[model samples]
Target: MDDVTDRLAQLERDDEELVLDHFDRRDAWELGHRLAHVALERALPVVVDVRTPAGILFHASLPGATADNDEWVNRKSRTALRFEASTALLGTRAEHVGFDFFDQGWLDPADYTVAGGAVPVRVAGVGVVAVATVSGLTSADDHQLVVDALREIMAN
Candidate 1:
């Protein structure tokens, strides 16, 4: 964990390990519900989302969340699903490598963000097929919730 990579390497490991055999709308619903339930237990204000490239499969907004969180969900989810990695990894890369995605001019801030919270849902053979995202908490916290939930669900 202390490779001096600014937490980037561990996040990359998470992406490497959190792979699925298959994912569908039912899986998304289960994941969304699990995330919501945990958020409730922690009294977290957040929006959880699960979606594929075509459309969203599941979404939930906890009480303290707002439309702004929804926007974060959209941006973070898009970034993760598009890049096939966790948003946190992107953010860390930006910090360590001085790579400003916004300055690159390839990614529009309106559609994508490197902030933590969204994680790409990768299938064993198919690669990334969707994304699971949380918004409203601090970026790291938001990212952790989704990662932890995915870890539990995958474990079971």
Candidate 2:
């Protein structure tokens, strides 16, 4: 997690001037496309959903991604928003909450998963958006793919 944080911080610092000033819709779309492309390159079917404070602005799913995966991605984004953490953290919380996490009502049916692969997109030191995620690879692989995608986006 420290690694991810460090990378994110570095990206923020690198893009500080550009990002601090604004987040453009075109940039978001370009980022989403780059992310999806990375997923495809990995041979993992993936769905990328970009959501701002207002609503979803971009969504893309590579071939072989299912409707279920799409739903998972959407829920993952919502979970990120509710927890103010990455979807991985939400998944951990769900595990701690146990099988009844859903039953106990501590988890939102649309905002919980142990499957991994989702991440929140933050700017200006605040998590103002999220990227819904689904990957055909292992959960860790999925997460890494998203991280790689984000890195590539920031590099640009």
Q: After superposing candidate 1, which stretches have Cα over 4 Å from the reference?
A: 1-6
Report the C-alpha lDDT of model 2 over 91-127, residue by residue, as the tens digit. Answer: 5544543545477687767666646676666566553
Question: What lDDT does model 1 reach?
Answer: 0.90
State which candidate has the highest TM-score.
1
For model 1, residues 8-108, the per-residue Cα lDDT tens digits are: 88887897899988888888999999999999998998999999989999999999999999999999998998888899988998887778999968899
What is the alpha-carbon lDDT for the whole of candidate 2?
0.62
Q: On a 0 to 1 TM-score scale, where does candidate 1 land against the true structure?
A: 0.94
| Superposed model 2: Cα runs more than 4 Å off | 1-22, 93-103
